[model samples]
Target: MKLEHVSKTIRHKVLFDDISFQIHKGLYRLTGKNGSGKSTLIRLLSGLSAFDNEKRLKLEGDVLFLDLNPIGLAPFSIKDNFYLLCKTYQVKLTPELEANVEAFFSDSYNDDYLHASVGTKLKLGLSLLLVKEWDYIFIDETLSTIDNDSLKIVAKQLVKLSKTSTIIYVFHNLSCLLLEQNSRILHIEGGKVREV
Candidate 1:
């Protein structure tokens, strides 16, 4: 996917101005200071929010965006939530998906939705979404809530998955996981985006 001549403005303050960038199929790490428009750029690139683009965004494939918010129905069983997500995205419950979820939830963790922590909920949501074949997967600070072990596991899994899907992991402060994954860096600052 390519974002050409992209710009965003809110409340009379310019967030980004006429920035052009291309998103390829690989792992990417997005970094910036607080309120630097990292999420805004993701929203624009992933078609979550409108851009002051004049229709300049050219998306090449279906995008799956997972932010800090745990995806799925809040008032449902874990199984039911997974099922609903799969149905919404038109994906099957493949073994890869099962493995992905298992990486986060051990054989011992409670399967109940209410009992699951934010990390577990996000993990389940991510696993269900990641199973699908998407052109780009933009994860914005969702993994930060997970415990260290699970984060490491998910990071490794994300690295593996990046070979097939374009994964964009965003953070306010850069993490070592990105370096370990050898992810390309996209930094947002001064109302501009640049590859570093």
Candidate 2:
């Protein structure tokens, strides 16, 4: 997919200025310093945000974006929230999905999901990424604060998911996992995008 001649501005300041790039199917690590336009560019590339189009915008896909806190209600039981998420995504609930959720939630499937730690909740959400099909998956610093074990599991799932979808992991800093995994790098700086 290519983003050609795209510009993004918020509050009269342009974060990205008429940038263009093409990337193919695979895992990509998007790196930039803080306050750079990495997340904005990811949103634009995911087709979640509209940009100033010097040419007609090009990127298109079913996109899943994980930005740390997932879409679980604080008052909802883990099972209810999981079911809600599946319903929201139109994923047919199956035995395999149930088993995965059970594993993620452990013995607390009936308890309010927010009662569990953040890492556990993140695992529950990431599990569904394995169950669903999508064209693009944008992870914006979702793994930065998770436990090491959860990070390892989510990284494995992401690597597996990249076989069929364009996975973009966005963070400000380089990660060992991103380097070791079969992933390419895209860095943003000074309102421009480039492969590094």
Candidate 3:
């Protein structure tokens, strides 16, 4: 994907301006201070928000964006949520996909996703997202609330997924997960983006 001269304005305040970059398949870390437009940038990249100059944006392949809270359909069971998401995405839930979801949650299939533990919910959401094919995946501080064990599982899955998908993750701190080798880190500050 390539973004040229991208800019965003919120409530008459400029968040970023003329930001441009080309991203390839790999792991990327986006870090910056609170209110520094990290989430805004992710939104723009994922097409959740429109850029000032849409013509300057060049995207390739399918894109998936997972926000800080990815636990969808809280009142429903994991099975139900999975079904709903797959339905929304127009994905056919085959037997193999069902088995994968069951394996992801293990014994939590019967429990309400909203009531599940934080780690369990995170694991379930991450596992569910992995079922679909995505060329670019943007996660905005979603894994920060998971436990160490669950974090490890999610990290391993992300590493595996990175082989075929471009992952752009926004983290407030780098100590949360051990990043993969050669992962690029970009810093956003003062409405400017610079590789750090």
Candidate 4:
């Protein structure tokens, strides 16, 4: 996928200007200081937000975006949410898949996901997304709230997913987890992007 001459302006300030880059199949770490347009760029790339030069963007295959606080997971049990997500994606909800999801959350399967802790809810949502098929996955600060153990598990899942899918992760801190060897790190500063 490629973004050419992309620019985003919010209010009266320009967040990013005429940025161009190509994304390949692998893990990518996107980092920048606060208000550097890191999240804005990810939103544009994932199609969650439209840019001024929308026609110049070229994207191939399915793209999935996971936000820090995912909506729609609330107001339902973990099992119900899993089934709902599967149906929404047109993925078959097999017995084995259900069993695996249950094991992922362990005793939290039958509990109300909305009432669960932030970390638990994040893990639950991520576990569901990990099983789905997508060519490109963009994660926006979703792992920042989890515990060290859960973070380790999520990191392992991310490394495994990178083998078959392109992963773009946005993080404010760099020492969160060790990225894969082939992962690329991009720094966005002053509305420009460069590999660091």
Candidate 5:
């Protein structure tokens, strides 16, 4: 997605201004200090929240924002969550898709399946980027629980998924997410984004 002159303001507070950036169809890491408007920018881009009057938000293609909270509802396993996500997107969940679900969840973790740990639950969420084929995917600092090995796998999956898509990932650990040097990094500070 391409953003030009996008800014957000609340009351008398100015979040950011004249924020213009062009992101290619690849993985991007958004890193910033605490309370740096990282989450706010993610919300604005994902359509979860609206930008203030001064900011202009625009998207060149499809986008989906994955929520940060990993705590899903009861009676909803990894399998069930994928099913519901596919259904909500009006996509057909075929047998092959189900098998991909199992493989993605199991392979990301070394476990035989997705019932391994709380981290796996996070992996389940990451798996959504691959399953739904969204043109743009926004992950809001959601990989905190993800470990090294799983992170490598997830990173690879993200790259593969981005072959025909764009990913705006918010990560605290820049090194982990930057395994692929080609990925762009954006730092948010004082309620503004700057490339670093």
Candidate 6:
């Protein structure tokens, strides 16, 4: 994916100007200070925002935008949500695979369905993403909520994704993960993006 001459303005001020970058096939971390418009850029690229003025967001091929708010609610049960997600992505989960989802999220705090808590819901969403195929995946600061074991699973999944899909993640915790430092880092300050 390449964003060429992309600019976003709000309230008569440009948040970012001519922000251009290309993400090759690999895991690239979008690192910058808070309020740098990182989230804005992610949302724009994900086609969830109309904030860009230049409208130069270009995607080469298939892209799966997985933000922190993974699954949208429809007043459905956990099983229904999981099945819907699978159907939307055209993925087939076997009976054993479905059982593991229940097993993975079961806890005393959670009900037998594992849909009682927000944490469990997030877990379900993460689990759903593991088996899907895509060309690119964008994750915006959602990994921090995962527990230790889940974090390990996420890291391994990301590494596996690097082989096929380009993974662009906006992360604050750069200490625990492995990524290429040569990747672009945009520093947002005072409503402007400066290459760092």
lDDT of 4 at 121: 76
Question: Which numbered prediction scores highest in TM-score against the true structure?
Answer: 4
User: Which portions of model 5 show Cα errors greater than 4 Å?
Assistant: 54-61, 94-96, 107-117, 175-180
lDDT of 2 by residue, 35-150 (tens): 88777777777766778653334446567878776668878877888888888888887897688667655577787787877766776567677578778888887777666655
| TM-scores of all candidate predictions against the true structure | 0.85, 0.86, 0.82, 0.87, 0.78, 0.77
Candidate 5, position 178, lDDT: 43
- Cα displacement (Å) at residue 14, model 2: 2.4
lDDT computed for candidate 3: 0.75
Candidate lDDT scores, in order, read 0.74, 0.75, 0.75, 0.75, 0.68, 0.66
Put down candidate 4 lDDT per residue, 1-196, tens digits, no spaces: 7877878888879888888888777789898888888888888878778887554344677677787875447689877777787777777667777776777777887889778777777776677554666788888988787677666666777777788888898866544445545468888988898877
The RMSD of every model to the true structure, in order and in angstroms, is 2.5, 2.5, 2.7, 2.2, 3.8, 3.6
Q: For model 2, state the Cα shift of residue 179 in Å.
A: 6.1
Candidate 2 vs candidate 6: which has greater TM-score? 2
Candidate 3, which segments miss by more than 4 Å at Cα?
A: 53-60, 90-97, 180-182
Please give, for residues 1-196, the per-residue lDDT of candidate 5 as tens digits. 5677767876767777768776677777777777667888887776677766544355656677765566444455656666666666776666776776676666543342335467776676676655567787888877767777667766777877777887887877655634447577777877667677
Where does candidate 2 clash, by residue pair? Answer: none
Number of clashing pairs per prediction, in order: 0, 0, 0, 0, 0, 0
Winner of 1 and 6 under TM-score? 1
Model 2: number of backbone collisions: 0
RMSD of 6: 3.6
> Candidate 4, residue 88: CA error in Å?
0.8
Candidate 3 vs candidate 5, lDDT winner? 3
